[model samples]
Target: MILLVVGADRVDAGKTTFSTGLLERTGAVGYKPRAGNDFWFDHDDCRRALADGRLYGKDAARLSAAASRGRAPERLNPVHRLWQPSPDGGSGLLGRSDREFVVDRIGRDPEDALFVRNATAEVPDAVADALPLADAVSIETVAEFNDLTEREYVPAFDRLADEIEDTDVAVVESYSDIARPLSSLDPAQVAAVAAVEPGRVRIYSGDRYCRACEIASSSPRDGAIEKRVPDVLDYLDPLERVRLPPLDKEQRDDPARIARAYANAYDAFLDAAGRV
Candidate 1:
């Protein structure tokens, strides 16, 4: 069964916290299909990943640790984008204001590759040099990045999906507020969906959630245009809402503590997923 955890807020939606707790409770393997971090705001994490010759967010690391067998962060997160703030108060290559797309790490382990965007040159020299550029592919335009992702991302996601097929449960954490991270992930395979925020979680039945996604999505099922939380919420009401109390730093880091604290919420998620 696939239990999908998505965010309502664009940032810090507590999806990771909820997911780690779920993984600890269910012994499910965690998969964060896509993730990214800002070079300016998440400098320490970015530098730590660069030191290891790869890039992945702290969320992926946390999920990795919380999983049953503890997969590598790169494996748990197949696609990781590295972003930087544009210094001149302008949009960078991807056309987002005050932000630039530095690089994207796709695939995992021996098959992994990096797509370094032209914006890399504009970042700090230390970051630029530390990035694994030896085998990186340089992208010069938005069209190029699109074309590359169109060819790479889905295939890489599929490869990772194959590895987790044997597990009883796979917990997928979406990136940002994206309704679904990978277009290739079949909603039919999803047993339940959780839309998370700072202090609450809305649980949706998989079939109804899939219907909402289909109705709200303007693009075809295989298209690149990702639907957001509000888009789908317009079509369906959640099955239930579970309150999540704030956690201290120590509790947040301990999956068992988190599971115990949020047992009711986790139980609701499993019941919705038909696990109960």
Candidate 2:
């Protein structure tokens, strides 16, 4: 088994897109290690999948369908953290403390509405059991752009790494850059990279010639992105590169084709890895 981590140069750079595409093409077991607390509530798709017996985070649902359907979303995304309103900001059952609010509430446990520490033990065995059964396994961390050093984040990352350590390909989303520097990443990012060590990192970015990409390419990380592109006959670095299509606005923003293009990019990745 090989672990193939799909990460973006920056957020929205298509990490999940590439992961889902690769899962489809490779028949890899998919695990979305870190998902938000309100994931199911926020995504109607996840609510639908869960209603049908498979519970998934937004990203996990897409991956489960594309790579291995029929498995429950809870199995795909076992470690989830809710981002509920802080207790001090609270009043209702979910927040409001009124009887009508209680009745109006979904009637689940009160603790369910709180953002608890990320506990790895929460990860069900079903995920571990399913991994070796596929061609490969792909794990997506929570959004990888924001608070990386938060104490709440590392346990889940450690847990995921331990879970998939033996697999042939381990594809992680955003942990690689955490160890860099504060100035390198966004502080208010909604996602965080897990701290799992990566064997190979493939930096995914859009076409440099694209207008939006050109602007994004102006950031500090963009300079890092530029340096990552090896010049002709340049010394081989450990990092491999995969460029996403220089899509028109429609194609670039289309969620469905995002997966398709990522699938296409994975083919290119395989060629680069010589896995082809």
Taken over the whole model, the C-alpha lDDT of each candidate is 0.81, 0.36
lDDT of 1 by residue, 1-276 (tens): 789999999889999999999999998889998888988899999888888766788999999998857468887888888777776765556666677777778877624565555643465665668766656788777677678776887688877777655557899999888887766666678899999999999999987887788779663221257788878888888888999999999999999999999999998889999942
TM-score of 1: 0.92
* TM-scores for all predictions: 0.92, 0.43
lDDT of 2 by residue, 138-196 (tens): 12222321233233334444544555444444333322222221222222221112111
**Model 1 stretches with alpha carbons more than 4 Å out:** 110-112, 119-121, 164-166, 217-223
Q: Which pairs clash inside model 1?
A: none
Best by lDDT: 1
